[model samples]
Target: MPDIVFKSVPFSKEDVTLALESGVDGIITDAAHVDGVRTLALCDVWAEADMPSVALGSKAEEESIAARIASGERLVLAQGWEIIPVENLLAQPAVAGKLAVEAASLTEARLAAGILECGVPTIVVLPEALSSLKSIVAELKLSQGALSLGKATVTEVRTVGLGHRVCVDTLTLMERGQGMLIGNSSAFTFLVHAETEHNEYVAARPFRINAGGVHAYAVMPGDKTCYVGELRSGDEVLIVNADGRTSLATVGRIKTEVRPMLMISAEMETPDGVRSGAVFLQNAETIRLVRSDGTPVSVVALRPGDEIVCRADVAGRHFGMRVQENIREI
Candidate 1:
């Protein structure tokens, strides 16, 4: 993971050095903060550090893709509203680039893939894309786990749990753990954490949620903990709760339904068959079960023996409800 610096903020190199001692991988920022003679200059000051730099386009239409190059920022975030064509995005070689598409549905994921094919190396999906983790995991071919180090970089072997030696970059993880490393020590309002144990990620620290009910993870959904494990249908996924108790769900099926929503069919058989045949089920809360008549029954209300197709819309919907047993872990 890279260290991210926002404009008009105060940070210290000692703190960044501490992050390097901790295990951060890289850094992110724009031209505004990188030009100062402050402590941030020492932040990722080492050339050998695994720290990759990303420059953020100031405005959507700012034509200065070279700002990062001029200011020494290596990686750049193509502002979401920016109209840089494929040629412009590929023309820049000073930085490894990522695109911000803030997906609220499946249409965004498909569009993201189309953009990737156009040459962007990275894509950030918004909160809406969290529900479609399986689809995104598959689409991105993300087969490894990620670990986040708050504010540090490493260059040597370090010891952990059992005589096991591991390498710590600016951020370090076992490479297969679904963990997150957060940067920046300010803005308590935008921090985020897994809503449940069954969530795609287990937070490294507590995240701040806003009055609007959106957390940092939801706000910059693309800037998130990487997913670990092999993605397949029928896998029991677990999302951890705020209290740390995990929720469970089975991957019943995966199919492209409407543009942004990937229909995930999960069948839940309760002991007594409760919410079966209830009407009034709407788009997200509705569950469809195959009945003897071969017609689908809508489980709008809580009932047993009612099996419904859980629609995991990539366009953005409530998909992380880790409130069950036998769930899977991201």
Candidate 2:
């Protein structure tokens, strides 16, 4: 995630308050208003006149800016810096976490932060973009890397008597194709669709995902994984959509109850030949998985050859963190 700075140069109190309320990382104001902004919030206040702003209109300037950043200088990007120069600076060795760009709009901010999948370390938003500040913050802050989701053919689905299942109630209401990724192993995970649909028997609990058995592993933000049994209120979970886009959601509560359980097994073709994965979910009408067409398929209706979305990776997770070692999971 990149830092978001709001530029309130010439000092508009309304704009500064908007920036503070929008949860910006810092506020860039003239030296005279640094105290004013500080009084508003304890966030970082950058002296606009003290920072060096360079316009990379030529190769010579680009090289100079890149060299300055390589030498540990935190430089701000002036207007008229093109995409080519930005890419060139990003490509320079040892220049990570040393660059800043002033974005004029949310689109530009998103592009600046999404460049090379590692954007500039800081984004300064001009006051002209006040209307889009909240949007810019929410997207650049909440968004995670798009995952690599593929299809797996269901091989079996069988009842496993009574067991404890976990229902993850999130602070955000998920849509039809949005849910959590869960599995017995971190490497092979299945997309467990949330309880967003309503039927005659039950009302829609769009903010809940009756995720799976307590022992299942859920893929979370920051490349981490957490067991469903260990999750608690106020924890963060990654909500993944069928298209692989992910966003962060706070765990409002964790509900564990004894229910009739079902085990779902699937197989997918991998570079190391076919690999299998399994997840234990509650045997209920609301428990579902994502299909190839982005529709939710109930676990009770799953059959052999039914293709569902899944993610496969190298099989190793040490204490919920990915590790590279010669380890086998059965």
Candidate 3:
């Protein structure tokens, strides 16, 4: 996540209050205001006098600032900064994650974020533009993190009788090979492909995923997971692709109904050894899981020895949050 610092110069108590409530990472204000800001919010408050600043008026000055950043100075605000100088500094291997730019408006913030495609890891926003702080922060944080997906070979598939299955309808239209991560255990999850590919019998539903049984866990943003039964409309879910890239999608609807379910189990080869996991999903022709080649394989057609993509983790979760505990789920 990128750091969002509120510049509280010409400090207004109301603006500081707004910044603190908006979930900004820190506040940069005058030394006299530091104590007052601290009294209101428990966040990093840096006195303006303590921060080093550089005027990017010349190439030499920009290079000097980059050198200082490379030598381990983590926070330096760039004034009169432009795309080229920021790009140049960012291109340097040593200054990759140490730069912060002052952004005057939402447009400037967007430019700062999209520079070099990775953007600066921090941005100091002027106090007057605090009204746009939330949206700006959201735009910066929406850049999805990547996941490491591995191959899992189908070991078993069997009818599991009738059970309640969940169909998640997201507001975002998903591609043919994208969907949510779901499984019985949080440690191992299957990339249950979206119902976007048309079949001879059923029309394509590009926004829906017949995820799994009600008790199954679906991956959420920030490395969390929630039971499919717990999800509701307006909730945010993580939509992942075959290549492990992810983005946030809002849940528009959740349909839970009795359906014939199938228990699908697979084994994955890991550095430690082979690990096995399973998910019970609707036993329908349209329900599918993602294959390694970025194609959707129908659950009805899945057979032993077929390879698919899955994610595994060692941490256990409680109430969708990661927790340290010796826990197991079948």
Q: What TM-score, computed on C-alpha atoms, does each candidate reach?
A: 0.24, 0.82, 0.65
Shift of residue 244 alpha carbon in model 3, Å: 0.7
**Per-model C-alpha lDDT, please?**
0.28, 0.89, 0.87
Residue pairs with colliding backbones in model 3 are none
- How would the candidate models be sorted by TM-score, starting from the highest? 2, 3, 1
lDDT of 2 by residue, 203-294 (tens): 98999999888989999898989999999999989999999999989999999999999999999998889988999999998889999899
| Residue lDDT tens for model 3, 14-88 | 888888887788898888889989989788998887665567878898888888888877555555687888888
Q: How many residue pairs clash in each candidate?
A: 58, 0, 0
Minimal lDDT window, size 10, model 3: 71-80
Give RMSD to native, each candidate.
20.2, 3.4, 9.3
What is the alpha-carbon lDDT for the whole of candidate 2? 0.89
Model 1 C-alpha lDDT per residue in residues 23-62, reported as the tens digit of each score: 2222232334444323433443323122232344554433
Model 1 TM-score on a 0 to 1 scale: 0.24
* Deviation (Å) of 67 in candidate 1: 2.2
User: lDDT at 9 for candidate 1?
Assistant: 18
Error of 1 at 203 (Å): 39
